[model samples]
Target chain A: MITLTLLLISLLNGGLAALIFFRGLKNKANFFFFLTLVATFFWIFGLGMFRMSSFENGIYWATLFYISASFCITYFLYFALFFDNKNIGKINFLNHLLIHSPNIITIIILLANFHFIKDYSLEPWGKSIKLGPAYFFYVTHIVSYMGYAIFAIIKRFRNVSGIEKTQLKFIVFGTITASIFALAFNLFLPFYTYQFVWIGPYSLIIMVVAITYAITKHHLMGIKTITSEILVGLLLSILFVNIFFNDNNLWFKIIIFLVAILIGYFLIRSVFKEVRQREHIEKLMKMRSEFLDIASHQLKTPISVIMGTASMFREGSIGKLPKEQQKKFVENIYRKSVKLSGIVRDILSASEFDTEKFSLPEGRLEPVDLEKLLIKIKDDSKEEADEKGLELNFIKTRAKISPIISDEFYLTQAIANIVDNAIKYTKAGRIDIMLDEDEKEVIVKVKDTGVGIPNEDKSRMFGKFERARNARDMYTDGSGLGLFISKEIIDAHSEASIKFNSEENKGTEFIITFQT
Target chain B: MAKILLIEDDNDQILLYHTVFKMNGFNIISAIDGKIGLDRAKNEHPDLIILDLNMEEMSGEEVIKRLKKNPETKNIPVIILTNMDKRKFQSQMLELGAEYFWEKTVVMPPDVVKKVRDFLEKNKIK
Candidate 1:
């Protein structure tokens, strides 16, 4: 029974390691996965020899333990290389030495142990061997091997980013559990043999579980799933484990088996549902990333063309025109320049947001005359408003000059965006810009008599690339980043807020309130 | 005028290239994809091929392979224009007979045009 169990455990370890090796080979040539296979092969060989009923040599067990220790050491080195993202070529010589050096040492040690590890006998469960002082070397080697793996894992954990760190943590935990079980079994085997044999297999199982999860879910080595049948197999294994281990009595085992079948059905169903949800999310994210990449590239071309053409025209490379025509050309250039700048800004902002690196720099907070700034903006918007046949007016209730401490450029840009949106959306009606001052705050309200926002789309109006349903129809050319940027600027100030009031076809009012 | 073949998928990019090349007095033959670009290179026999790495059909690498394979187009120096910053791909392209690999983000369109002109002038292939 003990021999059968050992064989089963060895088979499992060998099978898992082989699968990982093949999977790694399919993806690319990964040294760590290859090392894992080597380690598992040695382990399986050791276990197979140790479980043999006809085996009577103590040197055989010692050799098995030595090989296992050597494998463990190589495993640590491989794992370290993997975590560091170091190329295999960098340490090829050292890796070759380490992998081969043990075999040479083990052979020499076994040859010398001809007289040392002599006594061997068959116990009730299986064959047993009395260990020598040389066996301590094997124990020491295994311990040191585990120590290195732990050290590498801990050292690299602080620096590795994203999913790698999570995967490493899982690996560390699994290895630690396996190591502890091995250590316990090694130490207690002399006192009680069969008691801790199961620990090794159990720990191996944990390692398998952890590695399988990392490979399938985390894409730790980029091993893509080949079939859904594997998932089905895993479900069946779960059912088997539940049925086999959950009950003590035979009749209860049968009852539990039946119940486990039902549970397994639900479990499999839930697993599929979970997989589908995860896949859907992954697909959406992938599409979103692809869309962002393509859209940015696509948008860049036209912006580049406009900017390049404008620069060429401005430089008189396209030939000079009359003064009146020049003025008209400059105006056209200015309009195209603004549009290109806005698109470029949006693209940059979106990239920054994606990378989570966007920040508003601190600016000098000495504000100039508000009235002057408003007049300048109104003059800028006049041509745009005139083109659309919309009246743009700035109404000041109080003429009192109050200077606010804020970044003037951001304030101007924010106000300009609101005004630009008003001009773009309002076709026939007038745009009213009202300034009001209180004891604590200065309020700037830009209200436009245009096609108003729908109630359903109002909530997401400030989101990036989200245009109101009515606004989208009215102004099809807008990039939908203005409101999002406006919101960001407002949030950055921490003392400003934007509120809106609107009705369909009546108008929309964006009230920007800033602390004095 | 130096004959230049521009392999670009984006319509706007192609237009930009055409305008720039026309302004700079280069005879430009453009292709929308790599396969067409290769065909144009074989038929038109351009002095140099300005290849964009990423395209909808037939990548720049595929075009480079084809160019290197065909005796007629093999001598035409290929310049790779790409957004990818991967060193491995760059080395692979270099090994596969790309004369120069320039990142689009790092090198402006005008600079690229200038480089092409310089290559033509240096080779004296006009």
Candidate 2:
């Protein structure tokens, strides 16, 4: 009876190991599944050897059992490492070696027992039988291996997450129940009896519960439902044959095989259909964003022209008119044009960028002197800067020319935008443009003693259509496209990157770095 | 006084521009559309061409290309006066050899006249 039970347990363990090993191949990173397979294989081997008629030899049976205990402890250690997400190098290698060392030592000791006792005897109980240890060392090895597994489990319990935690709990309870049953059987029976012979099957039942949770919830070891469904369909077809044919014939088997093949083909087709539907939805979303961008770009050009011309008219550079009349006309144009222009530009730029079609054209790049460019830009902006009563200063750090190869017009436009933004935001403080060059890159820093960007707004400062909350509340007239355009131009330049550091109520500094 | 040809489509805008240029002592000749403007350029042989980009019959770009192709009118400098933003239109017009590019909103009529005067002075046209 003992031999029959051992044979059945070994076959069950081998089947479970094979299933886990197949699943492990799908997600190569799943070390947990691989470790489980290792544990199951060892248990199958040890039990199969012990139940063999040739292993009625006492020492051989003891060695196999000891090897099985060692593998169990190794499997628990693997579970701990998988959950922690810690570097494998960080796990103490010496501790792992120490844990597995006892199995080999136990096998050696059990072999030595052959000198003392040649054969083992089976003691009988109620409907089951237990093997007695002829060697003393075999008893010590079993106790030590169990103790090590319990210690590793306690150490790992705190680190696991979600379903793994529940699985660990079940495993611990099952192990304890098995250990208690073993103790009870040994105390009640005469001779050195194998305690808790029923514990092996009960432990497997607990593992199956954990495995079921892992498959349904965590998808552990990548054991997906598709494979299980196929297995179930095969089993159901077999059952149908037995019921319909009472006494089985060749014709019944052929009918079941043909139906199973048809079902399998449809299941594969449905999975492909689901994938195609998901791709179609993604494509529609992409097209919608592109349409919006094109519309915005089309609207922006005319609005900018209207605003720019109005500002020029208000300045009275065209002809001499009465002072009072000119002032009133200028003020009206400025107020209305600025507001409308800001809205149009912001919306358009945001939409264009979203569509991902706003790309800079490749231009001939040549070395440009930073100081000369700054002087020209300063001259151009002087009138507007003076009108606001704000001082715009260009402070040159180097006497020599700091040259960078980039698209001259676009680079000038980028720098001009930053300067314009500073003047617009600052009320009375100075705006400074500083140029410096290092060994490999040229740096242009635009510093302003203006209403600095607040911390909350800093994160979204470069985002499309986003303005600082304070700027919005103050009713500042800005399209909020200057920085966005500047960023795009700089990013397109092979040698340039733009960054800034700002503090609330203090000031903001924008730094542009270009590869020399 | 310089004999300037102004090609524009909008009635109100053309009236305003005509009045402003007339007041500045320019001999203003007008065309309501690109076809008439091209006809006037061939017959009158104006000293300068003031072109509007957004027109109903023919676009400013198309007009400029046609004028550049004609040997008789190729020497006459074209000035782009449009309601389109400077950043978008300026670079393209400049590359096409437009002597001046002005955004009508940011540039008043007076500034346009001054720019024309400067161009004439630089080229020694008068």
Candidate 3:
């Protein structure tokens, strides 16, 4: 019965190690944890074999168990150092060698069949071993290493909170309790009472169970899906094994196996689908909160201006003012109100893309004048461009460009967003707008000599509430929804595409192509 | 009349504050951005400074940090007028040694002038 429990613990450790290592292969902490689990499997399995082995084979089994224990403790210490995503300072080769020298010496002594163990005797309850000079060395290594590992975890626990704190609580509790059991039963009791050596390996189950619970319940390493799938696979394999080896009716066994396979298929599919939905919701919630933060700040600026200007007029407290000055302040209030409305329109237009039944109203679509629209956009942006000392140029092609059937309002907003982005980013250089056409396509390009988007920022350029690092540094007031809304508007039109080519510190050019 | 320095990037805001402060019997000094604001704070030595938080070239946070660092400008009281949420930035602005934080959306120009008058009178400034 004890042997069966040992085999079960070994299988659990091996399965969990494989599942986590394969799932989180790139994580440094996961790799160390995998090594620790693998080492524990061998330690527990070797201990079980040592209990069952004959007198002559007893020495060999004892050596295997001791070697595995040495490796297990070493790996556990490394795992603890890296646990909870903790870094232990700069890693020098000499420092690593110094840290690992004790384990290396213990393994070498065991491998040479030298001094760690002098004699072994088997009894009904457990096994006993006589101590050699190196036995004290092994004892000191185990006690100090395990003690330090627990201490490291406690240190980390003090520094971290939230879900990480809870995960560490499980880890620290399991490790401390398991180490206490192993020390009392496997080392101290074995030295004095000459029994319960087998209990050390059994105590490891507490650690494994605790970590497995953390993996499934707390999403440790965020490997919940992998653990669920592996568990399902393990159960299905056991059912199939019973079917093939049992002496039950052949047809009944076959039907039960097929049913199990069907159940496993749906089980695995639901787990994957649920996890993916959860991840997507998490990403969207984060984006929405960020958008709210930026949008509130943007909205308040215009609102404040309008409120202050209106309040000044209503109070009539500033004494007599010239009519021209009053007109200017009123104009300022009017311009700010217009800007506030524009911000509202942009936000609404962007939110439309988030809805399920998003479609442009049929009445809004019409044949838009391509040349006239570009000229108007250029004229409107000229004042802002001139304010920043940038020469805004428009190059009109001599060839007649044909108009496209589209929503003129949305199309103009989209094109103007790109133009506005150019003026906002360009600190010193000029912006050029051009309109050209071939036989089947109308091409409009807006180019600027500004801080260009880098390769790292390119992937998320059109994502909601995202800004390039350089752009955020240059201007703090952008809504970050402009490009996303622009892209969506352009994509809504049939056979239309928007693309950009940019180099950092040189410039960016956005090209919009529409099927003519 | 107490001299008031307005460090604001928005032209409309500068005009509004300038007119209101002038009409309220105070001399107004204006800087369009933080770099110019810091220079004016050093040279003009305005009795009280009204600083806008976000600006091109240099941020108001950097301006206040530099102001506190400089022996000449450290004593001049600064009131942060910004569109940022007061709850989020009030404690931080205080820690940076500003005398007060006023949210632009919440306070009208008249209210601001009144506050400035009260502050100057309480401090017994000319």
User: Best-fitting candidate, measured by lDDT?
Assistant: 3
For candidate 3, the TM-score is 0.66
Candidate 1 chain B lDDT trough over 10 residues, lowest sum: B81-90
For candidate 2, the per-residue lDDT at B25 reads: 86
Task: Name model 2 segments beyond 4 Å from true.
Answer: A1-33, A45-66, A81-89, A107-191, A194-199, A214-516, B1-126
Ranking 1 against 2 by lDDT, winner: 1
Model 3 spans with C-alpha error above 4 angstroms: A1-265, A315-327, B56-62, B69-71
How far out, in Å, is residue A154 in model 2?
A: 5.5
lDDT of each: 0.68, 0.63, 0.82
- List runs of model 1 lying over 4 Å from the truth: A26-30, A55-65, A85-89, A92-95, A98-100, A112-118, A187-198, A216-516, B1-126
The DockQ score of candidate 3 comes to 0.58
Per-residue lDDT over A216-295 for candidate 1, one digit per residue giving the tens place of the 0 to 100 score: 67654322232343544444444434443434676765665567546644554555566657776887687566556555
lDDT rank order: 3, 1, 2
Error of 3 at B106 (Å): 2.9
Candidate 2 TM-score to native:
0.35
True contacts kept of each: 0.08, 0.08, 0.69
Worst 10 residues of 3 chain A by lDDT: A237-246
Q: Please give the ranking of all candidate structures by TM-score, highest first, separated by commas.
A: 3, 1, 2
Listed in order, the DockQ scores are: 0.04, 0.04, 0.58
> Judged by lDDT against the true structure, how good is candidate 1?
0.68
In candidate 1, clashing pairs total: 0
